[model samples]
Target: MRLRWPVALLVTLLVVVLGTLMGSRTPAEAAKKITIKDSMGRTVRVPCPPQRIVEVNGDVAELICALGDAGKIVGASSYTLQDKFFTSRLKKAQDVGKSFTPSVEKILALKPDVVFGYGKFLKPEIIAQLERAGVPVVLLDCYKIKTMAEDIRTLGVILNRQKEAAAYIAYFEKYRKLFADRVKKIPVNRRPRVYLEQYTDYTLSGPGSGGAELLDGVGARNIGAGLRVPYPKISPEWLLAQNPDVIIKACGSSITSGYGEKPDAMAKKRAEMMRRPGWSRIAAVRQGKVYMLSSEIFTGPRAIVGMAYMAKWLYPQLFKDVNPAAIHKEMLKKFHGLELKGAYVYP
Candidate 1:
């Protein structure tokens, strides 16, 4: 109590030091939390990189795995895993229900701190359910393959894995150039009169679809160009009138209009396309120009796989040197340590 001024100051410093030594937090605890925004404009803040995450988009799950981290995800929409798209990655995943009904109970049980989802398909009600419960939901859209590669960077920024994301985007860019070079060399006469088959039937992609865009990307001419939404129904007779040189079947979601699954079964469900019985004379069938593609590959980040397949299909001579199947196999090895399957046409 009777200490001199200098001594008092020294004592105060000692007390402050002692308190800091006893009460200071570890470096890990002091790190700043990250806040991310979903495409729908909701903000998600996490105290730390979470141990459990719920994903609504199948492609987002694939991209996360490609970024080398699927172990962080605990929940997914049921539809994604039902198909070949999730073949290798579904071992640790659990179904949360369809895109329309992601099980609140199931997701809640996982106790996910972060929910990563995509699409306008996820209703506002489901999103509200998550936000109301204080779960941070971040939406990432990768509907187009071109934009899909860009979205990896967005996810990277959120997950704090920027380098991995950049690496993936860079990889996709290389393929884009490979496609462009081949496209640039094709002459007008050699460009195939391409038909973009959206469904098993005569549903054709017109001027404005991912399939149509990809067809254009590889310098092929779409016979259905200038139509409204692309994949409008076309009559078999009308299709024969055009006499397309090549036909690329690009499947999309919603395969159940009572459609049976098989190349020949296509005639039953898509009766309008039956090139026989009441109607059977399309040049595509007679010439054997038809090819089947995966439904999932038609949209989402998986579209990259679709695009690679498209490039190879459009110009076998040009891309004969490049093996699309081999590229996918290599992607699986480096990205997910899983094998690629169901990404192409089945015999």
Candidate 2:
């Protein structure tokens, strides 16, 4: 009670200092939590650099692994393991179930901080259950070519990997432009007529579809452009009448037996198409312009590879120097930290 003035002043300053210290937090502390808007237009509060995550979609899992956060994945869809690329990288992640029907029990047991899922495929009830259990799920739609860059960026933001996201976008756009810039110079009259066999024979990709978009990007005319549906079945008669200049059969993903293990699988598929009734009279069959295309490339971030190959097939004179296989190797090495070798597309 009889303390000196200096001592009293010192004690008051100590109290003020303690209060200020208690009120403030470091940048790291503030960065722990972040809110983001996913592709579904729903606001989600998630942990930045989430420690544990579950991936319901293989493509999303692949993208996350490519962004250098593979360690964060605690669980993944069962189909992810089927893809050689994902299987090699996501060896640590437990298979929860199919992407569209993930097991809620396994997911809850994993106690993931967040789950990356498909908005269109995953049932709404499952999403609701997860949210009710305090798990935040961010839905992403990567089906369209236009939304891929944005989807990658959104994922990057959520995971606090904006730099990686920007880098990926740059790489993706570079190849996309590599196709568009050269193809745009070709005269309209020279555009080749392309018939795309989608996931099966007779099933074709029409206008306003991912397959059609790839064909359009490479300055090729989709023979099914006039079809009423985005994806329609072309009768054998119709296909023969169209007489496309180039035909690319999409293999894998609903195709019969996934191109098989035979070394001549691609050749066999081509031969089968050529042997189809009335196909011998088709211009594509006669000129040997038919090729086998991987469905994975046309429907994923790797569509640039399909574009390159399609351009080469459609206009060999224009894309004589374009090498899609080399581009594929480069992309795998650069983004995926992988040296995957396979026949993605072939004659």
**Could you give candidate 2's per-residue lDDT for residues 1-347 as a string of tens digits?**
77567878999999999778766743323347788887789999888878888999776887887789998888998877666667666778888998999999999998888999987779999999999998899998665567779999989988888999899889888888888888887787778888988886798998767788888788888888888887898799988888999889888654422212332666777787789999889898888888888766776778888888888887788889989888888888999876746667765
Q: Give the top-scoring candidate (TM-score).
A: 2
Tens digits of per-residue lDDT for model 1, 1-347:
77577978999999999778757653223435686655555566763555677888777887877776677777888766665545566577778887666887788777776777764667778878987887767777766555666567778876678888888787777876678776887787878888777755678877655677677667888888867765588886777788777666654454421112344433233434434442335555566666666665555554556667777776777778787667767766776666654424532
> RMSD to the native, candidate 2?
5.3
Colliding residue pairs in candidate 1: 204-231, 205-231, 206-230, 275-279, 275-280, 276-279, 276-280
Question: RMSD to native for every prediction?
Answer: 6.4, 5.3
What lDDT does model 2 reach? 0.81
Whole-model lDDT values for every prediction? 0.67, 0.81
Q: Estimate each model's TM-score.
A: 0.74, 0.83
Q: How displaced is residue 55 in candidate 1, in Å?
A: 1.2
